[model samples]
Target: MKGFFDEVRANLRSPVLLAAWGFMTAMMALAGPFGSYEQIALPRRLIVWLGLTALAIVLATAVRVVVYSRWQLRDFWRGGTVTSALSVAILAPVLRHMAEVAGDAYLIVPPGLVEIAGFVFCLTMGFCAFRHALETVPPAAARAALPMAPADPALPRLADRLPEGLRAPVLRVSGRDHYVEVATAAGVASLLMRFSDALAELDGVDGLQVHRSHWVAARAVAGGGRDGAKMVLRLTDGGQVPVSRTHLAAVQARGWLDQT
Candidate 1:
């Protein structure tokens, strides 16, 4: 149960989820579906829409917790789709009941059908919005455990900082709170070194710091793309590195942005 609440808190903390809620609220206010626009004042309609959004988020979070705990479905889209469907299923009927209790007029369709259709439509919109948000938000930094690389007599200083087995071609280095996560062809390892110090060790390496917390090898960059307002460099290892606003122009100047 504690884990369930923790997951819910994490979801709610997501900027993407919050943005979706705001967008859905505005759309509901304008569309006035379920006779909400005509039956209530603007302020009340906004409040009701906000309440519905909150309920949907909570229900979806709970459903996600169950799906993940019992079924072990970890894929983002798959879990989100299930949660969205369940949320709509539960939210639609509850909304209809609320409308009846409040004595609000039904829209063009019967109250039950109207609530179902309206909630489904809004949820769909929210899902897409959240998906886009996920694309833009940077992933959490973590090092993957893998076997070490073969010994190289001429290993660089940066390679020295890594563990014995992980001395392979560097892909990228991402800064955690107090550690630097070094990604290589062999695997990943976290070293207790400042990000700036790590970059200094790679003095002769061909790479650049794209973000405050991220530095990527020039050879490791396979392509690039736009994620909302940010530019992302796709690494050879299938990792995406976000380029901060401060270094966007520098990345573009270096032709990294032209790859994709």
Candidate 2:
């Protein structure tokens, strides 16, 4: 139950995703009971409209994410605001017409005024979405971005060293303070990094975090064991990392259960 809620929270926390969902919801509300091109039975209309709304939200979220991936957070938010505003403004007619389908005619607002209102509402929603996205970034992310420890009066400076490219590969990414653990042939190495930055750096890697604190290299697993709802990843070096139930299938699909 807790894990389920965490997943829900993570989805809601994404700005581009959440913003797209909101816009899609508004679009559905405008489509009326049966949808854009139909005047079906009341029950059928409600079900179809709701199903399409859900599908649209998912698709819109995916498109926004793919586009946003190439841009920095700031630029993405700025552009997304403009795009969202424009989309809503243009769709006003479709939405208003849908509202008129239930016997009561929707107020015929001037196009100029409707567009202005949409722009303002979308802008506000977009800004709030961006702010929430930034705020959701964990503090440990900052540490991962810069691995160098600052010079301090009480502690001597030490050279930072990343693990040599070994036979074992990175399993997953998780952040805590200034360290990120990479599951490798040797074992888990808690290196200096914020969790978020480390996750971002895993663009080319083929792995996923099985738990909030554990990442498993895709190719390092020797076997697996289970403990109630928790999972254990057995490595070549006799090391094991716990996998949350949430990521159990992902781990198994990576052949974490197969032994050479």
Candidate 3:
């Protein structure tokens, strides 16, 4: 349920979604499927169109939440089809009600047919928007190919800061508020140490701070990829670390970016 709301929030903030809604509103006003385009005043036409578009978008988002929660379909196209169909089912009656309120009569086609067509058009637009949103580089697959440095028996002083069992080959160190989360070959452990002090203790380990909050071992980096414009590094332990813009040039200079 939390995930569903999160998805809804994300979708609402998407630029592609906003653009789609704008396009739909314009088309609804200009096309005038239920009446002659010039029959209604421009202001009234725009108001009606905007209202209907908002209603449809809200309902479609709700349908997506339900479909995604109830049906865990892995295939993208198949899942989209089912969700779109369900959205249309919820859209039909609301569209009719809005049309009647706006004093528009179904012109060439029945109200039902118009509603179906409108819903289908909206669904197609949504699918395209999502496809654009999902266009991200796959995680780096070359982590295994990278050579690992010799495991030094002399543990870095940073090991003293970790729990006894977690004092192994550190993969990454991430800052979380006042604590630092240390990921190692053994497992993950959190210690209440200042991030700067922790970095000073790891003097012998070959690693770099990739982000304001993240420091990753050079050998642990599997490869790199792009999530939209942001750079990401895949670690041997199957963790993805985001590279901040401030540190991107430094990471690239080390040949880490080329590995992806």
Q: Note each model's CA RMSD in angstroms.
A: 16.4, 14.6, 17.5
Q: Which regions in candidate 2 have their CA more than 4 angstroms from the true location?
A: 1-176, 183-190, 258-260
lDDT of each: 0.70, 0.49, 0.69
Task: Choose 1 or 3, whichever is better by TM-score.
Answer: 1
Candidate number with greatest TM-score: 1
Residue pairs with clashing backbones, model 3: 143-222
TM-score of every prediction relative to native:
0.46, 0.32, 0.44
Worst 10 residues of 2 by lDDT: 152-161
Flag the better candidate by lDDT, 1 or 2. 1
lDDT of 2 by residue, 1-260 (tens): 45334434444565655555566555545554223334444455446556545543443343333333223222334536644554454444554454555433223332344644564356445544654444232344554786644432321111122332221445444454455545443333344566766666555454567777766555556788775676788765455678877887887787775544
Can you rank all candidates by lDDT, best first? 1, 3, 2
Q: Taking the candidates one at a time, how many backbone clashes does each contain? A: 2, 8, 1
- CA RMSD (A), model 1: 16.4
lDDT of 1 by residue, 102-215 (tens): 663534444675657566745754674465344321222422343434546545567755655567878798887666778887766656678998888775778889999999
